[model samples]
Each structure stands twice: as structure tokens, then as C-alpha cells.
Target: MPAAYQPPVAAMRFLLEHVLDFDAQMAMLPGLEDVTSELAEEVLAQAGRMCTERLAPLNLPGDAAGTRLVDGEVVTAPGFAQAYADYVDSGWPSLAGDPAYGGQGLSRAVQIMLDEMVSAVNVSFGLFPGLTRGAAEALAAHGSEELKSLYLEKLTTGEWCGAMALTEAGAGTDLGLLRTRADPREDGSYSIIGTKIFISSGDQDFGNNIVHLVLARLPDAPAGVKGISLFLVPKFLPSGNGTPGERNAMSVGALEHKMGIHAQPTCVMNYDGATGWLVGEPGRGLNAMFTMMNAERLFVGIQGLGLADAATQAASSYARERLQGRAADGHGPVPIIAHADVRKMLLAGRAFIEPARALAAWTAIRMDVADRHPDPQARAAAHADVALLTPVIKAAFTDLGFETTVLAQQVFGGHGYIREAGIEQYVRDARITQIYEGTNGVQAMDLVARKVTMEGGEPLRRYLALIEADIEHAADHPLVPQLRDALALLADASSVIAAAEGDPDRLGAAATEYLHLFALVSLGWMWLRILAAAPALGDTRTPRGHAALARYFAAYLLPRAGLHAARIAAGPGPVMELDEELL
Candidate 1:
């Protein structure tokens, strides 16, 4: 049997109820009044049970079996289809979807937690719903009414799955240079002819159909990205009454032989004169796709949280049970958990994970407020927070997640590197998160160039102010002073980035470090929030333990903030000065 995952239920509950206060926020939303804390807890408990029982058993097997493309059709690992069916039948897919379209309309925060658990149990399987939710969000926000009626309910209910078709043979991040063609048809649809690479869940056998949200260029369009358009293409073209009718002119050209996530079919999609309807206004595909990309970015961050949490659970469990060298006290051979290095590794995992979970949930809560908050200015501010933090969440969470998993694998020594312990699977799975949904480098550049410097750094200032308020609340703690100093560094770095607008290389050099600084500060803020809320709890052990972890973060992890700030302050001078051909 694979190492069992002990779901961090206590920590999740603490963050959701105490720190994020999602229940209180939900009470104010129009349709979320019914989503009480007790109900949400119950929902999570059931989902956790489903993951442990249904999904956990499939992880190793799925990894071993992988996905196969036979007879020009993609087939998932054994038991995956049934697990997905169970997931949908349980109303899990509709957890945060539109109620008007047969969804439950729960708060997005609930979905965030659910996703974290599901992903921990099975990262490959999680990608199936992850992509669908993104595609559905884009369609719900930008799709025409007719398109909504035809596809939204089905996608929300998991009757149909979805894919984002963006990358091509010659283009990845630079979509402006893509050569895909979308010719206008007399029937108001377009003939989408393109070959898109790195398409997740591009084709699957479980759902009734696959819905694709494709990015392509239309004829008579301008020279660059502004000319691109978004289209809705499906595996099977719909009949007049909305049933799967004729076969669409699209096929999975090949499956990517990837380093990880073997259970998911990452495809090279060939769209040959496929009939597709235009989504949103003409020449505004990026605008429409951002709705999906932003959502996917957050979901991808949660994937990091999931894999890291799983590794933490497995490695810590092993450390407590696996017999190793003698303890420092000269006791007989004991479990490695008694060793200082093992304890440090486990603590580091906790230090990274708990705060990341809080930030992810907090960001999702902001998304809710951005959409449903009563005050206009409050909504705008919440939306800005979402924008500023989205990239940080995506890049930092995945990067830390990959690091945490490797640390966990090291805790197992040689066994961790092999497939038997399952820790290695996480390392492989976590690698992709950094590369997809925009590379971490691209995300950092976006944070510096678009999010931070956009609008003269008002958003960054507002975010720092929130951190200041939290710092004041925890002023008595020893870590407060350090956080305060780091916050200043963040402010200084933002101003520097904003001022160096004319120098692209300088901006590029500082972008990643600035983002890491921002992530550490954000995580520090979350740690403080958790500490503040811990005192109110009846049980003191959780708080006391978390307090220790918070101290560990401060003494060790937070120091990296200063290192990143130093890099940021140095600008791109040293980096740019290096000769291209130097050894």
C-alpha cells in the first residue's frame, strides 16, 4: 500500500474559519447565505473521505498505468473514469459554479479547499476538473448567451469536460506570433484551423464531450496579439437541440511524453476546419482568455499546495516510524524523527505550507468580494488585490511546492528517490506547475511590469498597508519587527521597479527577486494572522505548535526576504554585464 495521506483537516479548518473568515464573508453574498460554516465543514469532511478512499488508492496505479493513445483515442488510467464519475455525481464539480446553470453557487473559497484536497490525493486526476473549471469560467464570463445555454450547464455538471488550446508549435508565451487561422463562415461561426501544443486534457474518455476554448487569429486582423480571437470548439459538434451530433474536425495529433502527470493526456491538438463560435468581441481574445488564465493560475497554485501537503504527510509519517541511527541522547536506534535534520525538514514543510494555504484561501476570498461586494470602491480594491497576488500565488506556491517535495524525498534518503515511497511522484508532478499556466519567470515579470508598476504602484501600496495593519495587530510578537522591516524593503523595491520603466533588462533582473520578496512578506502576513486567531481557540496545542513553526519561519525562511531584496536593489547591472560567451 502507498503511504497514507493524513489530511491536514485541523489546519484547513483553522485557516478557513478563523483566519480567512470565509463563512462570515459568504453570509453577505447574494446566493451564499445558505453556505454556513457547519455546512462547509461537512462538505469538506465528505470530500476528504472521498479523496482518502476513492482517489488515494488510484494514485500509484495511475502513475504506473499512465494514459495511452491507442487507435487514435486517448484512454485514461484504470479507475480514473469511475473516480471522475463519483466526483461529479457527488455535486463536487458544481460546488462553486453558477446556480442558474444547475450549480451550487458556493463561495470560491470552498472550491479552493476542495481542490487542494483532491489534488493531494491525485494530481493527474485533478487536472481534469481544473481545466474544465477554467474553461467554464471563461465561457460563463465571455461566451454568448446561446453558447452559455448550450455548454455552461453541461460543463459545470461535469457532463462535458474542457481544454484551453493556446500554445502552438512555434509559440508558447509569445502568442502574438502564432500562425493559426480562423476564417469567418457565413453561418456566423468560424472555421478554426490550428495546431495547439501542450493542451491539457485535450482529449479524454470519461466525459460525454470535450469543450475547447481556443485562441486563434482571424483574417483581416492586425499584426500582433490585438488581432487574436477566442473560439469555442468541441469534440463533437452539437445538434440543433444541443446533443452531441456530428464529429468535429479536430483530433489529438500526439500525446506529450512528459516527465510527470502521465495520467493526464497533454495533447498536440490539430483543428482542421473545425466549426467554432467566436467568444466575446472581435480582436479581444486575450481579454476573454485572461478570465480562464487567471482562474487556472490560482488553481495551479493550489496544485502546488496539494502535492507539497501530500509529501509532508508521507515524509513526516515515515520519519516518525522508520528506524534509523541512534538518537543524540545515546538512546537505542530510533525513528529518524528524533534527528535534528529530520525535524528541521518537517518544520520547513509546515512553515511553507500553512501560510501558502492561508494566502490561497485569502486570495480566493478576495475574488469573491471583488465579484459580490456591495461597495464599488471595495470591489475595485478587492479585484486589485486579486490581480497583484495572483502571480505570486502561482509562482511562489509551485516553486516552494517543488522544493518541499524534494526536501521530503530527501528525508527518506534513497527510498524517497524511488517509486516505492511515492515521494518521487510528487517531485515529478510538482515540476510541471512551475512551467505551465505561464512560466514562473513570466509570472514574475507580470508582477513587476504589469501588476506592481501598473497605475503608479497604488495597488502595491494598498497591499503593504493591509500588511501594516496586520503587523500592528501582532506587534507584541517578536517576529513583527522583522516583518515590518521586510515590508519596507518591499515598498522600496516596488518604487525602484516603477522608476526603472525605461530599462527592460533591469526590470527583468529584479522581477523574480521582487516577486519572491513579495511572497515571503505575504506569507509572513498570513503567519501573523494565524497567530492572532490562535489565541481565541479552546485548544492551545495547535496554536502553540503553529507558533513554533512561525518562529522557525522567521528565524530561517524570512531571512531570504532580505537576500531577495538585496538582489532587487542591485538592479540588472551585474546580470546584464555578463558576456554571453563567457565560461
Candidate 2:
């Protein structure tokens, strides 16, 4: 039995083979010569098994049982430590970490598929490793060479764990409001003293030593975000023999009991004169932190993808098993899945997840290029693509993830709300994706403000051109005639936003709508492209399923794209004009 989970592998296959052109990615990445379609399927199949058999089984209890906080230590859910150990032993952790640092150094698409699998299986578990990916990315990008050698290897191998400490009670969204201080010591170290709240993996027993990447302001520094600096604040001092010695002055002040992802500790950390080393130069900490934060944002968005996958799978399973009212044309009391409305809901869920998965994977593939392209210009182009797509991947995947998870819950109807049923966990787990790692609203603002206008939409223009090229390449193929049309819809959405002028409010209100529109049309593009590549998905000959998925999105979901077009056209007037006390 497949259990209550959707097979993201099939979707992943569609993406890798058809949508992303996986073989091309393998040709690009060194040591990925073995990543043929057959190998890819086996990898995805194993991922599905591990996630479904190992992780999903623990999620419900993990939520109900949660993590134990005793004496300022967070003990993750049952089987978590062991499962993670097994997962590490399996080499999954190294999928995304740099090759120089004991990682597999495979394409980002591989990592995204792995992430989606784990997230779909158990979100809390997803956090523990997901944080590592962010931490490793930061270290690789900004940390000193010494820092990279010391931390990246251990963190990469899962011998050590990592957490980012950026948020304070006063500075949740606005880093400018933070009051943490870092005074440079006579040596190369600094003395960090501050309070950080909602720090994930701040204090955990999962690894030997937890590395806290803290953000603080230096003495004589200017005010606000510009004044801040980043520090390597370890939980305990690293001794000469790969062991932990003196306890660093960082502790968990409190732990939160949240609505979801309970086993993933949400902590208030106190850094009291902790010995710290600067990762990058002072007054540039925000810039350095964003290196990690951007990666985290994308991972968090994938968290959304994972939960939605779980929800849809769970709902789909329940729908096929649960006897419900017959379809108007069918025999009595067939499975709910036999009904037209249930099919609609399942299709709706797919409408969100399939394309989002493709996009996330595509973004990851680009990451490989950014990180490893032999040429500087090619690397820069990859970096630019990663930057431009990061917000869209984060925001669009998550927003759709929430909707799909809810629909999954609805598929189960009354049972989903009950804890024993376990469907609610997906709902609860997915909610956090929208809240943390830069709120979806923040993501929208970044998309509209920083990503779009700042570049004069050149980045977006480049992405559109790439899509255009993909359509042109696939034009003569039987499965690709519809791709150009999808590209046109996506192009229109991008152009409308790119075309918008001086009216910030006009741009702002429409920002969310535009992102949604872009996501759908983009997914439509992904679907068509992936469909063309379906031959690699064990059999591209069956165009029926892929075509139906495309049609479902095109007919039903694309209208939302149009709706967003309307909202974007309306500008911000209706949204901003409302007075504060209307409620």
C-alpha cells in the first residue's frame, strides 16, 4: 500500500525529464554522468519510499508528542535523531552542500526533489536538515576559508548542525530594529550579547555542536540594518580535537508551543557575551545574512510544497478508500474519488503542486550553474537567475501549497480536523511556511520592489526570453505546440508587472496578484515543457495524463491568472484607500 501520500517522484520525473530537461543538467554538473533517466527514477523512487515509510509515519505523533524541552534543551520527536542519523548515513544531507565540503554536489533539482519528499513526509524533520542547507550556503558564500573548512564539512556530513539567529522580539521582520551588540575583542573574536527569538534549531540534541549564525551591531557602528554584522556563535567552543570544550554563552531563554511543526523547536535564545567570529565584514552583515536568508526563503517555500504534497496524497488516499455518495452517473456509494467534485479537488491540488515542484527544481538546477559554471559570466547569469526566481519560488509555491493542503484537508472532510486522522498536521505545518522565512507578504514586496523595478525588470525580461527560447526549441514536437501559448500568457503577466510605472500603491496591491498570476502561467509553461519531455518519465507516449493536468490548470487555474491581471490592472487604489477602523 502506498499510504496516505502523493508520489512526488512521478511529478518530479515529469519535471526533470520533460520540464527541466534533466539530462542536460547532468551534462552540466561534474560527477553527475550517472544521473540518467533510469537512475533518476530509482533515486526518486527511493526518496518516495524513505519519506513515506520513515518520515510520514512519525509526523502525526511528532506533532502530538512534540519535542521535549528540559533544562533549555530541545529533544526532537521520537525516531527523529535515529531517522536523521539514517538519513545522513544515506547521504541525503550532502545533496545540496558544496562538493568541496563532502557533499555529492549534484544539481539543485535533485536537492529540491529530496526536500519536497522529506517535507511531504514530515515538516519538522525537514526543518532540522533544511536549516543546515541554509547555514552551509551562507558559510560557503561569505564565511572565511577557515570558517568554511571548519564548519561546512561537519555540517555537510550532519556531524554538526546549524541554525541562523537573526530575529529578535523587536526585530522579527525589520532587522533594522534589532539591538543585539557585538564588540570586537583584542583577538580576532568578538563578544556577542543579545537576545534572539523564534530561532529554529537554536538548541537541539540532534548533533554534537550547534552553530548559531547570529546577527549583531558593533560598537561605533551606524544605526539600523546597515549597521549590523554577522557572527559565528557556536553553542559551545570547538576544541582542537574535533570536540566541544567550554560552553559558549548562548542558551535557550524560552521555547514556543506553536500551532504546527511542534517538534521543530521555536526558541528565544540569549547570547550573553558569547565568543563570536565575524563571518564577513561589519556594516555588511545584512548583506552577508541575506546570502543565507535567500536560500532559507526558498527552502521554506519548499516546506510549503512538501506539506501540500502530503495533504494531497493523504486526501487522495482517503478519497479512494472512503465510500461516499455515488457520482450522478455511477453506481451507489463509490469511493469519493469516483465523484466528479472530488476529482476536481484533486486536480486543483495538482494544479498548485506539480508546477510549483517543477519551478523549485528548475530554480535548484540554476543554482548548480550559479555555483559551478566554469565561466564567470555564466556563473553570474546563473546567480542572477537564482536571485530573480528565489522570491517567485518562495512565494508562489507556498501560497499554492497552503491552498492545496487545505483542499487535501477538505478531501478528507470531517476527519482532517481530528488529530488522530493526521491530516491537520499538514495544514498546521504548511501554515508556518507563509509566516516565517520572510512572510509571503514580504516576499510579494520583494518581488515587486527589489526584484522587478530595481532591475527595470531586466531580470524578468531575461527569464521570459528563456521561456520563449524553450518554446521555440520544442515547437516542432507533437507535445509542445501548446507551450508557446502558455508562454504568451506568462509573458503577458510578466509584462504587465514590468510595464507598471510610478504608482507604488498601484504596484503594491497588485503585487500579490501578479506573483500568483506569474506562478500559474509559469507553471503552465512548465507543464507544457515537462509534457514534451514526458518520454523520459518511463513513457512519454501517454500524453493523456499530462495533457489533462495542463488542461485542468489552463481552464480552471489560469482564470486566477486573469483575475490577478485584473487586480494588477486596478492598481492599489481599492486596497490603500480604505481607512483604518473600518472593521
Candidate 3:
């Protein structure tokens, strides 16, 4: 059996109500008057129960059985289709979609909480709806009304599924080099011919139809990324009545045998003269698809947070039950939880997971603000905040996610290496988060190159100002001093990177480390916000636990801020000094 996943209901509720102040934020977003703390709690509690009871049981089995390509069609692991049916029947996918598209129109923060619960229990299962929602959002934003009329409702309601087909064999991160072709036909659709690899939820056994958001080049278009265009292609072409009709000319060539997430199909997809309709304008596919990528990036970050927490829970539970060597007091053999080393591992996970969660929730609230805030200036500022922090969340959450799971597995001794205890499964499942949704390395480069350097670091400075404002909000809290110092270090580091205008090498070398530094500082700020909010939450275990975790994070984790800041100031010389041919 997989470990029992206890949804962090209280933690999520505390943050939604107290720290992030979701109630107040919701009130500001028009048409969101229906969202309340009570609704959020209910959604989380129900979603959590479903995840633990329904989804968690399938995790190991999914991993063991994996997905297969049989007779030119992909078949999902056993139990996945039923669980997904239940998931759809629960109306969960509609939580964050637009109200106009047969959805509940809930705030993005609530969806983030739900995502954490789903990911913690079964990440593979979660990808189906996750990609569907991503595709729906992209289509709703950029696709023509006729396309949305035909597809968005089905996608938003979980009647159909979606996939992002961006990478060709020749193009991984460099979309400009992609050779996928889209030749226009007189009927207004295009013939898409390309192969997209490593596609998550590319083809599966569950949903009725799969809608793919594809990137291809128009025959007469300009070269490079500027020539790319986004298209909506379906497994079975929709008839005039918007129902499945004749089969599209796309097929799953093969399934990827991967190191992790075996239940989720990582596919090699081929589109041979597939019919597709263009989205947005020609030569602007990147701009259109970014709508999906940005959303998926943050969602991937939360996946890391979920897996980290799940692993920690499994390891800590095992530690409490498995008797080991005698305690330091020389008594009989005690549960390993009595050992300080075990406690250290547990604390490390807590330190990172709690604040990382807060950061995700904070960012989710900003996503709502960016889209729905009444003031135009506030919306733009919120948009900037989202852009600046997305990569930090993506890279740091995943990198630390891998580390936390390893630490959790280490606490399990040899048992973690095997699958029986279920801890090892988390390790394997989490390994992919670092690699997909754009590798953490690419996220780091984007942080430095686009977010910081391109705009002369105005966004970074603005984010620092917001942190300082929060510091002022929590001025009386214990972590305030540490928060102030981190704020300063982040500000200084931003200046250093901004100053390196002509030095791409320096920017590239320091980018990853700088992102780590930024993430730590961001977490510290979150802890301070939690501390500030704890007192208002009344006498409860949630507040008490929040205080303890904040102290632990400040004492053990915030000190790394100075180290990263120092390295940022040192520039790229240490990294770039060596020649490529050096022994």
C-alpha cells in the first residue's frame, strides 16, 4: 500500500486565510465573490480525502505496470482510467477554468492547493487534467472563438484531454531549430508533419479525445522561432457538430521507458499530415504557448513541493515505527525518530516544504491579481511579480525537491532503495520534475537572461520592494531581522547581475546559483509572513507549528543567503576560467 497521504488541510487553510489573505484578495477580483474560506476548506478537505483514499492507492501499481503502446494505441496502467473517471466526475478540473467555459471559475490559489494534494498522492494521474487545463487556457486565450466554442468546454470539463507538442527530435529547448511543417490548405486548416518527443499525457486510455497544442512552421514563414505557429490538433477530428469523427493523421510512434513517472505516458508522437487549425497570428507561436508554459512551470514547482512532502511523510512515519539502535541515553533500541540524524532529515524537509508551499500559494494569488485586479497598475505589477518569480519557483523547488526526497530515502536506510516501503517510488517520481517542464538549468538561465538582465532588473527590484513591504508588515516577528538581511542580499545580487550587461558568460555562470539564492530569500520572506500571520490565527496547533517551522527555517536555511550573495558578487571568473579542453 502507498503511504497514507494526510492532506495539509490545516496548513493550506491557515495560509489561505491568514498569511496570503485570500479572503481580501478574492473580494478584489470581480466575479469571484462566491469564493470563500469555507468553500476553499471544503474543496481541499474533499480533494484531500479523494486523493488519499482514491488516488494514493494506485501510485505504486501505476509505476509497476506503466503505460504501453499496444497495436498503435497507448494503454494506461490498470486502475488509472477508473481513478481518472472518478476525478473527472468530482468536477475538479473546472475549479480554475473560466466561468464562460462550463467551469466553477474559482481562484487560482484554490487550484494550487488542489494540485498539491493530487501531486502528493499521484503525480502521474494528475498530469491528465493538468495538461487539459493548460491546453484549455491557451486555447481560451489565443484560439479563435469558433475553436473555443468547439473545444474549450470539453477540455475544461474533463470530457476530453490536452497535450503540448513543442519539442521535435532536432529541437529540445531551441524552438527556432524545429523542423515541424505546417502547410496551409484551402479549407483553412494546415497539414502538420512532425515528431514530438517526451510528451506528457501525449496519448492515454482515459479521455474521449486528446487535443494537442502543436508548434509547427508555415512553409513560407521566416526562419527561426519568429516563424513558429501554434495549432490545435485532435486525435479524432471533430465533425461539424463538434463530436469525434474521422481519425486525425497522428499516432503514438512509441512509449519512452523512463527512469520515473512510469504511469504517465512519455510519448514519441508523430504527426503525418495531421489536420490542425492555427491559433493566434502566424509567427507568434511562442508568445501563445507561453500562456501554457508559464502556468505549467508553476504547477511543476508545486509538484516538487508535493513529492517532497509526501516523501517526508513516508520516511518520518517509517522512522517512528521501525526500531533501530539504542537511543543516546543507552536505553533499549528505540524508533529511529529518537535519533538526532533522523530528526535532522525530517526537519530539513519541513523547513523547505512549508515555505516552498507558501511561496507557491503566494504566487498563485498573484496570478489571480494579475488577471483580475481592478487597478491596471496593480495588475501589471502583479504580472511582473509572476514573471520574475516563476523560474525561481520552478528551478529551486525541483532541485530541492530531489534533495529532500533523497534525504527522506536515506532515513529509510536500505528499505528506501526498494519499492516495498513506497518511499523509493517518490524518489523515482520526483526525479522527473527536475528534468521536464524545461529543465531546471533552462529555468535558471531564463531567470537571469530574461527576467533580470533584459529589463535592467527593474522587476527584481520591485519584487525586493514587495519583500521589504512584507518585512515591515511583520516587523515585530522573530524572523524579521533575517528577512531584512536576505532582502538586502537579494537586492545587491540583482544589482551585480544587472551590472554585467555585456558579459553573457558571467550571467550564465552565476544564473543557477543566483536563482538558488533568490529562492532561499523568497522562502525566508514567506516564513516571516507566516510568522506575522500566526498570531492572528488564534490558539491552535497550526499557529504553534507555523512558529516552530519558521524558527527552524530561519536558523538553518537563511544563512545560505550570504553565501550565494558572495558568489554573485564574485562574478563568473571562477566558473569560466578553465578551458574546455582542460584535463
Candidate 4:
């Protein structure tokens, strides 16, 4: 078997304390004054213990056993129910929820740390609570007071779980194509009739109830996306006292058989005139749903970050122990770690994993600031930052995450291919991250077409300025100049795409490469920050380790930014030249 997951507690602490200065940042945000570095460390440490002891062992078994549909109910794999119960009893789900809604009200940065741990050990299990948190965020932002009072606490406390019912058989990314319909009732409720496919944790026996935030159109609603409206449809209608009461007119049509995350029940849901309530203003469903979708996009990015770390840990452990070819001294067979090629694969994974973790955490901190900062200007700036980086994180993190897993698998040679080695599971699980939460291709387009040009490109300019300021701080560092050059390339590419506003094909053709270029530069900037903070880390080995990885990233990974920039400059004609039916 592959080496068991070991949470990067020290590394996490180092980022929070030294590199990101998370505690200081939290102090500036309203209501997060008490979120100290020590508290964050303790929380991460305890979460790591829970994941290592309670959740990690369930991963392989859960995947092997998977989920099954029996008599219209989805039954989870063995031990999952009890594990979820334990998870709730320990109050794990309330980490970042609103205090008024029975949540601990911790900073999102801290919650994201816990999320990374959960995802690393048991991604299948993480989906159960992950979707709940996303639902709670949407409802908190747009749900009626009565709806929040009636359901928010239970959802926040994990007494109930939530699922997003958005995709239909014919609609995946295009919400405008959905045929689901909702009709208003005299009692202010609506009758929802639709089929939603690819709903994760759509139904489960573990939670007392499941609150589905569905997207549907009204009877007189306009055509396309403008007609869409958000609704809250519960599996069990709430009673006078708020407990689950009568069953709603909904059932699992079927559970999907997938390549990985087998323990997560991806369901096709049928809402046969299900009783529902409108979440936001009429004809504004997509707006409310995007609130949840945006949160999920960030959460999905962390999922990739978690898997990358897990796969890297497993491969590094194997490389240190597994004897293979002889060392340069021509002695007996030595550990694979001694081989140059094996070291390359391992270092490449590390180069991506460390910076990716930093970037995810950095984004989470900005999210908290965007939501909680007392200053309007600060909040707006943070919001702009979050909007600009969300798609990049979602796309690049998952793309590299899948690549890191495959690289780790390569390190195992033939052994990695087998089930017994366990590395193959990470590869299979990582594959889906790139495809879901809007495919990486779609995310790339969003980054280039919308976010880059949004506010007349002020957000992109602000982001580049931030990087340039930081580069100035470490001007003497060897990697700073490389990061500076990459930033310029990204800026030039952004301007190129922005200049082609009239041509849709230009944006489409340059989207993926531009996003890749952006991610590389962003990660390069992260490595520079790490190098600057290495001295305060207080240990020779730790600082030296970070310096080496920073060097490796500059030498091996950052150069790709140049290639992506070149591709972006190549324009769209070559891509658009081919006819649809041509051979």
C-alpha cells in the first residue's frame, strides 16, 4: 500500500504565521480579531488528528464499497454514516459558518485549512459537508429571513446536509438551456418540477435532512437564463418546530457510476411537483446560484491542492524506501530517491504543491476580507482580487493537481498501476476535479473573456501591481527577477486579449494558454514571497528547504509561462482555420 497521509501541520503553520501573516491579516478584519495564529494552529492540528484517525482509514474502503441505490434511497458505503455522525457530533461542519446560526464563526482561511485536510484524506466524504457549506453561504447571502431562521442553523451545524440541484440532462454549464419549471402557489410556495443530474451528495442516510438549492424557471419567466429562479426544496418539509416532517415530492432517479470518488453519490434527482420557496428576486436565480457556485469553485480548487499534497507525500515515502537502480558510486541497488529522474518527478510535484497551497490559502484570506472588512474600499479591492483569481485557482490547481498525481504514480513504476499500491486511486480521483465545477476549459475562457476585461481591466491591473510591489520587496533575491519577467509577460498577454474585445474567437483561442500563463506567474510570485519569509521561519533546514524549492520552481516551472505567452500571441487564426467537418 502507498504511505498513509500525513497532514502538513508544520507547513500549514509556517504559512499562516510567517509567509501569509494570517493572524495579522485576521486582526484587521471585523469580528476576526480573536483568530490568532495559535488558535489556528490548534484547530488545524486537531482537524489533522480527526482526518488521520477517523477519516483516512475510510477512504480506500469507501471507494471499494462505493454507494448503492436501494428502494429509491441512496445508501452510502459501510462506516460512512457513523463517520458522518461523528463528524457532526464533533461540530466539524460549523467551522466557518455565521455565529448567529450556531457556527464557530472562524475565518474562512482557517476553515479552508480544515477543508484541505478533509479532502486529502477522504475527498468522497468531504463532498457531504462541502456542499452543505456552499448551500449555507448562498442562503446566508440571499435566503429570506424565515428561510434562514427555519433552516440555517441545522444546515450550519451539520444536523442536515445541502445539495446544489443545478445541472439537468441537457444543461451542464449553460443554465439558459434548463427546462426545469417552478409554479407559484397561494401559500407563497412553488411547485417545482424538474430533473437534475450530477448532484453530489443529493441524498444520504447520514443527515436528518437534505436541503436542495435548485434552479428552475417560472411560468411567465422570460426565455433563457433571465427566466431562471433559485428555490429551496427540502427532502423533508420542516414542521412547526423545524424538525423534518412530511416527505417532499422528490426521489433519486438513479446514482451515477463514476471512475472515482465512488463513495460520493452523484445522483439524478426527480422533482415531481416538489414544494419549494423562491430564494431571491424573481428572474434572478443565476445570481443567487453563482454565490454558491463561486464558493464551490474555490472549495474545488482546495480539493485539488489537498490531493496534490497527498499524492506527493505517498510518492516521496515510496521513493525513500523502495530500492531500485544503483547510485552514481556503482554500489548495490539504492533507494529510488538517489536516482536523478526519480528526484525530478518528486521535486516537480513539490514545486507545484507548496506554492499551490500558499495561493489557495492566500485566496481564502482575501475572501474573508472581502466579506468582513469594515472599510468599503478594502472590501471592494479584496472582492476584485477574489473575482479575478477564482477561475485561475479552480482551473490551474485542478489541472496541476491531476498532473502531480500522475507524476507521483510514475514514480512507482509498475507498482503504482495496481490497486494494492493505492496511488492509482489519487489519479482517478484527481481527474474529476479538472472536469467539474465548470470544466477547466470553461474556467480559462471566463478568466480571459470576462474577469480580465471586467471593470475595463482595472482588476487585472491591480493584481499585477500587487505582484510588482512584492517583487520590489525581494529585488535582490535571485528568483525575484524571473517572477518580475513572468508578471510582465502575463500583463502583456492580458492587454493582448483585452485589445481583441470585438473578436470572440481571439478570447476563445487564447483563453487556456493565458490562464496557464497567469497561474505560473501567480505561483512564481508565491515562491518569491516564501523565499522572502524563509528567514523568519527560525530553522536552518526549513528555510533552506524553501529556498531550494523556490529555485527549482524558477528553473523548471516558471519557464512555461514564456511558452504560454508565445501561444497567446500566436492569435486565433491557426485554431479557427480548420473547418468543422474537415479531416
How many steric overlaps are in each model, in order? 0, 7, 0, 0
List the global CA lDDT of all models.
Answer: 0.89, 0.79, 0.88, 0.91
Find the 10 residues in a row with the least total lDDT in model 3. Answer: 535-544
What is the per-residue lDDT of model 2 for residues 1-583, given as tens digits with 9 covering 90 to 100? Answer: 2246755666566567666777877777666666655567677788888887888788877888887778777777888889888888888888756677898766677777888788888888888888887888888888998888678898887778889999988798899989999998888899999899999888777667888899999998898889999999888798887677789988888888899888888888999999999988888998998988998898888888888877887788888899978678767788989887889999998766776777887788788777766788877777788887788888888888988888888888888778778888788888888888888888887887677755566667787787777667653543254445545655665666666656577667877887776676677667767666655656642224666777777677766655666677676678888897893
* Residue lDDT tens for model 4, 157-194: 98899999999989999889999999999999999999
RMSD in angstroms between candidate 2 and the native structure over all alpha carbons: 2.7
Which residue runs does candidate 3 get wrong by more than 4 Å?
A: 453-456, 473-478, 537-543
Residue pairs whose backbone atoms clash in candidate 3: none
**Higher-TM-score candidate of 2 and 4:** 4
Looking at model 1, report the run of 10 residues with the lowest lDDT sum: 535-544
- By TM-score rank, best first, the candidates go 4, 1, 3, 2
TM-score of each: 0.98, 0.93, 0.97, 0.98
lDDT of 3 at 471: 81
Taking all chains together, the TM-score of candidate 4 against the true structure is 0.98
Model 3: per-residue Cα lDDT at residue 553: 78
- Model 1, TM vs. native: 0.98
Model 1 regions lying over 4 Å from their true place: 540-544
In model 4, which runs have C-alpha deviations exceeding 4 angstroms?
540-544
